[model samples]
Target: MIKKAVIPAAGFGTRFLPATKAVPKEMLPIVDKPNLQYIIEEAINSGIEDIIIVTGRNKKAMEDHFDRSVELELLLEKTNKHELLNTVEQISNLVDIHYVRQKEPLGLGHAILCTKKFIGNEPFAVLLPDDIIDNEEPALKQMVNHYNDVQSSILGVKEVPHNDVDKYGIVEIEKSSTSLYPIKGVVEKPAVDVAPSNLAIVGRYILTPEIFDKLENVKPDAKGEIQLTDAIESLRFDQSIYACALEGTRYDVGDKFGFLQATFDFAMKREELHEPLKKYLKEKLEE
Candidate 1:
């Protein structure tokens, strides 16, 4: 069973700029909760017992958010804010979370490699907090279910516009009728004309321990950073990898526009904000 998950949040969040100068991008708020919280909740709901978060400098806030704030809790208790207190306590008790420093801002593949010790010899899940998936079933859970059936590594994939294939790790697949595709290989940010398929690998992954070996041997690209897609493709030569087309809406919250869309969508789902927010948007559109 995949009981452990890794979250590689050591990035500099250069895109978010000045706002991210002091704050970890993963700690940026989406609605009332930090973005990383949503990912952790998904992991916990998906039966993940332990999580190793790969962090870098200025990411201490992310760590503190999950840790217990005793003085704050006591103040909340004294103020008789029972509901707020419960929420705070729940965040702290969510799961068994561990942290490992990546030290340098390598790349996604290197960040994940930092968690090898925590993962030991078992299969594990890797979730990128940038992609917030909204679905009836948690995205990682869906991948886990597929992993159970196939007993192989799984990558959460979704079809993207052919023009957008260059923006993602495109997978070459053996055609199949079901949502699951038998992955032939994966190319990282291939050119539009050269992309094998429009099936783009998303942030959720169920990877085997064997991947660690592949990652270790993967030569850095011209950019001097290891790409996880390269490691996964190398692993494919040894064992099969399958891509499961996840059922849900994926918000690339790492992007500015995508983050705004997620914020608006999540706000519209809240009972207190739904009606008024809907009315306000309608009026703005009519203008």
Candidate 2:
């Protein structure tokens, strides 16, 4: 069972622009709760007992979110808002939240390395908040089930257009089966025509702890950053790595357009806003 999960929230959300100037990107709300909260809930529901967040400077908002706010609790206490107080308390009680500082923005590999001590010897899930998945069974839970059954590290896969393969980690298939396929290798941002497959490795991953060592040995790739895909591919010679096409809609909230789309779609899913938001969009469309 994957008991530990790490969420790396140290990146500067440059795509969100002026709004993200002072705010942590993870804290941006899709509609109600912060974006990171969605990922946290998903991890908790997937049976991840411990959540280790790798944060950096100016990311205190991320830390304070998981911690108790004594002042606000007192204010709510005076107001006698019992329900609100309970909701506030729920944040700290949700799960065991641990934090490690990533002092440098070396790469995704560095972010994972920051939590080495906390992960110890167990397999863990790494969920990137940028990729918000909509599924009946949470994406991580689905991956976890696959990992337990196969006893192999798994990557979340989603088919993309051939031209877009260069935008992600493209997989090279070595063996194919009914459901699972062994990857010969993975190339991050390979040129469009040279990509081996259109099945791109998404942000969700169930990785063995041994990835830490592979990450340590990998040299910096094209952009002078240690790409985690490079490390995962390096492990192919010894470890069995598998990919599963995630069973739902995945919104790449990292981009500006995707973020706006997530806000619109997520808001449209709420009982309170669905009809009204749809009507509003339809009216605007007519205009």
Please report the candidate that would top TM-score against the real structure.
1
C-alpha lDDT score of every prediction, in listed order: 0.94, 0.88
Compose the digit string of candidate 2's lDDT tens values, residues 129-185: 899998989988888888888888888888899989988988877656544667778
* lDDT for position 180 in model 1: 80
Q: Which ten residues in a row have the lowest lDDT in candidate 1?
A: 103-112
Clashing pairs in 2: none
TM-score of 1: 0.98
lDDT of 1 by residue, 130-230 (tens): 99999989999998898889999999998889999989999999988987889998999999999999999889999999999999999999988989999
**Steric clashes per prediction:** 0, 0
> Candidate 1 — which pairs collide?
none
The candidate scoring highest on lDDT is 1
**TM-score for predicted model 2 compared with the true structure:** 0.95
Provide the global lDDT of candidate 2 against the true structure: 0.88
Which regions of candidate 2 fall more than 4 Å away from where they truly are? 174-178
